[model samples]
Target: MIDKIAWLHLVDGRILSTRSRGKDVYYLPGGKREAGETDAQTLVREVREELTVTIELSSIEPAGVFEAQADGKAAGIVVRMTCFTAEYTGTLAASSEIDELAWLGYADRDRVSAVDKLIFDHLHEAGQLS
Candidate 1:
């Protein structure tokens, strides 16, 4: 299993997502947690690296945990995504491995990875997403 962290940045009922360089699908902003890092620390650093915006650590909150088959990977390989919502600083701009940025609603499920689709569904069900 591959474990990851994700930021649930919702704006106007849409969520912020990123497409990494060479990847076809978009994903929730954030990445793998480094060894010895707390989830908040991982989120702050990963969001800064991927979105060029620093997540306000104190504002971070647990959104949900999701898992799915890893896209384009070996059978049985799964990605466990721990998600969060938080305030952040700086304008969002793609950086590092990120190649594209998008604000997605529930209608955009087909555009993201499986675990991200689950997040969208959850947010939509809670009326926090479109």
Candidate 2:
């Protein structure tokens, strides 16, 4: 399993997602944890690197975890995504390898990665995403 972390930011029934350059699918905003880094530390650094925002460490909360076949990988390869919700400071924008940023809703489910699609379904079921 490829372990990863993700930031789940929802606004008005849509979730924040990013598309890396040259990729066709969107993914939640976060990445793998560095050596010896806690989830919070990884989250703060990844969010800052990918979205140019500062995640309010105190506001971090576990959202949910989801796993699925890693996109574009060999069959049986899996990605385990640990998700979180937190308040942030700064305007959201594409940074680093991100080519575009989108606010995706359930209707856009087909545009995200397998793990992210699971997250979308969960949020939709909870009535947090439309």
Candidate 3:
């Protein structure tokens, strides 16, 4: 299984998503945790590297956990994603391997990765997304 963390930046019923260079779909902003790093640490670092924004660790909170067949991988390979919601500093922009960023609503679900779709489902069910 591939493990990763994600930031669920929701505002006005939309979530933040990013597309990597040459990729067709968008993904939540965050990355795999480094050795010995906590979830919040990975989120703060990855968000900064990918979006040029600093996540306020003190405001970080668990959003959800989701798993799905890893996109473009062999069957049975899965990606486990842990998500968080938090306040941030600075502005958001695409950086690092990210080429574009978008604020996605429930109507844009199909444009995201499998695991991100699950996140959308949960958020929509909880009435935090639309």
Candidate 4:
């Protein structure tokens, strides 16, 4: 199983998230890996396209890894999401393929993916949620 990683930003106690067009659930603002792309490369490009920001990769800190059943896939098709927190530049706005951008709190967990729910749980347990 290939694990995908992304850098997430928590600003003013709100977690950054995005939703693709016609998608019901909000997701962490990131994307999948391109062929032969490194984790950092995938993260950098995905965040830029989804959130319109430049992630300071050097400032990235591992947060947690989450696993869940892949959406629209059969059982055992799991998605491994390795999460990170980092400092970044530029004002965040929905861009490229993102249809909506949001800042969600713990109470909004049900609106996100299963893996993201784990992320919120971890953040909440660690007193990181605002």
Best by lDDT: 2
Tell me the deviation in Å of residue 110 in model 1.
0.4
Please give the CA lDDT of all the candidate structures.
0.90, 0.95, 0.93, 0.83
Q: What clash pairs does model 3 have?
A: none
Ranking by TM-score: 2, 3, 1, 4
How far is 53's C-alpha from truth in model 4 (Å)?
Answer: 1.2
lDDT of 3: 0.93
For residues 7-125, write the lDDT of model 1, one tens digit per residue.
89899999988999999999888889898999999999999998888888789899889999998999899999999899988999999798899888889999999888888888999
- Cα error, residue 123 of model 1, in Å, equals 0.9
| Best prediction by TM-score | 2
lDDT of 3 by residue, 15-129 (tens): 9999999999999999899999999999999999999999997899998889999999999999999999899999898896999999999999999999898889999999989
User: How high is the lDDT of residue 100 in model 4?
Assistant: 93
> Which residues of candidate 4, in runs, are more than 4 Å off?
none
The lDDT of model 2 is: 0.95
All candidates' TM-scores? Answer: 0.96, 0.98, 0.97, 0.92
Better of 1 and 3 by TM-score: 3
Please provide, for model 4 over 8-82, each residue's C-alpha lDDT reduced to its tens digit, 9 standing for 90 to 100. 678777788889988999989776889999877888888888888898979877777889887767778888998
Candidate 2: list runs displaced more than 4 Å: none
* Window of ten residues with lowest summed lDDT in model 4: 1-10
Q: How many residue pairs clash in each candidate?
A: 0, 0, 0, 0
